[model samples]
Target: MFDVNARIGHWPYRPVGTVDDLLKNMDALGISCACVSSLDAIHFLNPQDGNDSLARAIAPHRDRLVPLAVVRPEFAGWQDDLTRCLESHGMRGVVLYPNYHLYDLDDPEATELGARCSEAQIPVFVQVGLEDARRQFGRTIVPDVSLESVGAFGREHPSLKLVALGLKFGQPDQLRQPLPKNFYFDTSNYERLGDLEFAVSHFGVDRILFGTCAPLFHPRANADKLRCADLTAEQREAIGQGNARALFGL
Candidate 1:
């Protein structure tokens, strides 16, 4: 699951023991591969430091997990830092924390960062919402990362792929028609308020990927949702694993 919302200190997280521990857990959950980020970054301080912690934790077992670097694109020299990350760490996908970073998604820096990521062929993971924020104790005035900004960036660069991590229902239909060929979405948080049937029907199974936000949420819930749904075997497979493989070129 390439979800952007998982954290290190969440109540439901299973402590990661080793790379083997993570892999074995994924196997037990029927997940072959995932792009993981640090929970500390999503909940604690700056995302870059959290990313560093995650990198240190998973560096040895990179074979099992694909690290999606969490970055605040607004910070100075972030592009250089990102280039170094892609070069040294072999990171392919980047997760943006627009809410925690406290910047408008339409900011010029964010726009440039998207283009830079596009040039690097690195996909972006953005969150539409993280439902547990207020319940977990945090400040107010958190600016949401508007989909319109992501759409504007996508429109500007047709080749860049953008994935919305936790989109909710009635969240506006930007992806309704003439859908951006480059933008994709996940089915992790679809348990409530998501149009799963419509996504499969309109976006096609290939365009939607499966993500369970593991530890924070059980993979079984999502897997069961896909299983019980009225879809063809091929469609289910695409949503469960095939789309992920294609997205990551795995």
Candidate 2:
């Protein structure tokens, strides 16, 4: 399973730790593989620094792990960073954190950036929340990415496979709406497992994948939650390993 969300952070501003520690836990929990990034890079500097950190860590362990390039279009020369990620890091996709990066989806630059990602045949993942920071760290906070805006962006960029992570406070009615065919979501910040089943039943299993914003949250709990759900074996496989495999061409 390629975990679309995981981080390498050990600085004062960072919350998580090394990638090896994550791999150890992944091994113990029976996760074969993941595509990881650095939360520090995402929250701190522009994408190149974060992408460099992730690229270095995953280089030796390419068989078990993959690198997803992090890019901040809000910064200068982001296009070069985007090019390097595809040409150098061998990134299958890139993820964004508009809330953490303090950018708006409605901006012309952000819209073009999404278009650039689509042209590169790279999927884009965005973090809707980061580990419920109020409970995890101190009194830090980040704004929620309105699902409404994301839906509109997906509609605008019809060819891009846009993914939303850490989706919280999702009502069942939201799942029933006709989302873009290219739009998908991951499972994290979940209050109940039944909603995932409802999402799959309404949107089809291909649109959902298993994910855990790990090190901040327990990977075992994340894996177990999907396993224990009231889903068929086919649905379970799709979320567990199949969809990510298909998404990243693993």
Candidate 3:
């Protein structure tokens, strides 16, 4: 399986272990590859440090890990950094931490950045948050990108292949609501029984991607969720890695 969302580096809220730990966990869970980003970049003073570390860490493990560069939309020369990540490091995508970076999807710079990514044919991963409000640390009350903004952004940039990680809708009707036609949801947080069937039935398997959200959430458990879902072979294949291969050009 190719995990659509995963991370490496030290997180302040919890222990993330090492790159080897991540790889070992993936191996145990039968996860063949993961598109990983650096947590260090989420709130770092020098964002390049995180990107540099990620490139270095994944150098020897390119077969099992694909780097996802993190960029601050408001920063000058971020475009150059993204270019280096693509042209030099061969990263498949970029991740945006809006709450941690203190930017909104409606920001003009963010819109321009999205346009650039769309033109480049690179996928963009938007993290809603590391954890839910109840699980967050006391002093750190990080906010999430509003679903309305996500839907709006998707509508504005039809070409942008948006992937929303940690996106959960409480009601079934919300599942059918208008979203970016090209948008996909990572299945890291989707674990309720019959949820996969319902989502697949409603949204089609093409819009769902396998994601473990490893370390933060157990890869094995998430893997089990899909493995146990009553889905057709084609649906399983699509959610497992087929959609990711096509969407990411892997």
Candidate 4:
């Protein structure tokens, strides 16, 4: 399986463990590859530092772990950081946290980043929410990224590959249709019994990717969700890894 949403590094509220632990969890779950981003990057003053750390940590395990740079386009020199991540560090794609970064999706910087990623032909993973709203710390509450903004951004850059991670069960229905062909969603945070089946029917099998949201949520939970979903063998394979392989050119 190719996990499209996974993270390494610290989470303030809990111990997220190390890369070795993640690899072990993946091994147990039969997940061959995972697109991992830095949890530290979300709140970093210079997010590139987190990207750099991730690049180094994943360098030795490039065969199994695909690094995704966490980029905050609002920061100065972000262009240089992105260029280096793609060209120098060999990151497969980027993950954006608009809510934590405190930037609107329609801002010039965000637009420029989307355009650039489109031009580069790399997928951009947009995190909808890191934690459940009710569970968020009152002292450091970060609202979820607006689904409207996500849909609007995808419409603006129809050529870009946009993956929305951590979307709740009912959230996809809120996006205006017809949904962009290039836009996709992961299987993380969909806890309802029929969520996977609903996603397959609503978003199409090709648009759904297997994601564990690991270290924050157990890898087995989502894997079991996929296992129990009412899908054909082909549809199951597509979501498990085939879709991600096609999207990321793996």
**Candidate topping lDDT:** 4
Report the lDDT tens digits of candidate 3 across residue range 1-250: 9998888888887777688988999888889999999978987976767998889988999988989999998887898898888999888898988888888888998999899989999888888656888888889788767767776777778998998887765422343475457888888876576978988988778889998887688788779989999999999999999999999776
- For candidate 4, write residues 83-156 as lDDT tens digits: 99999998889899999999988999999999999999999999998798789888878888999999999999
Cα lDDT for residue 76, model 2?
89
Off by over 4 Å in 1: 1-24, 43-45, 132-144, 172-176, 192-195
Compose the digit string of candidate 1's lDDT tens values, residues 1-250: 3322333333323353433544566777666667787666665555666666777777776766788777777787777767766787777688877886777667888888888888888788886665555454454545446778766767777777888876655342654466688887777776643366777776677778777666566656776777677788888888877877777777
Question: Which pairs of residues collide in candidate 2?
Answer: none
Between which residue pairs do clashes occur in model 4? none
Please give, for residues 77-133, the per-residue lDDT of candidate 2 as tens digits. 988888898898887788888887888877887898889988987888877776565
lDDT agreement with native, every candidate: 0.68, 0.77, 0.84, 0.90
Clashing pairs in 3: none
lDDT (Cα, 0-100) at 93 in candidate 2: 83
Which regions of candidate 2 are displaced past 4 Å? 11-15, 136-140, 169-176
Q: RMSD, each candidate, Å?
A: 3.3, 2.1, 1.6, 0.9
Under the 3 Å rule for N, CA and C atoms, how many clashes does model 4 have? Answer: 0
Give the Cα RMSD of candidate 2: 2.1
For all predicted structures, in order, the TM-scores are 0.84, 0.91, 0.95, 0.98
Compared to the true structure, candidate 1 yields what TM-score? 0.84
The whole-model C-alpha lDDT of candidate 3 against the native structure comes to: 0.84
Between candidates 3 and 4, the lDDT winner: 4
Error of 3 at 136 (Å): 1.1
Q: Candidate 1 at 224: error in angstroms? A: 1.8
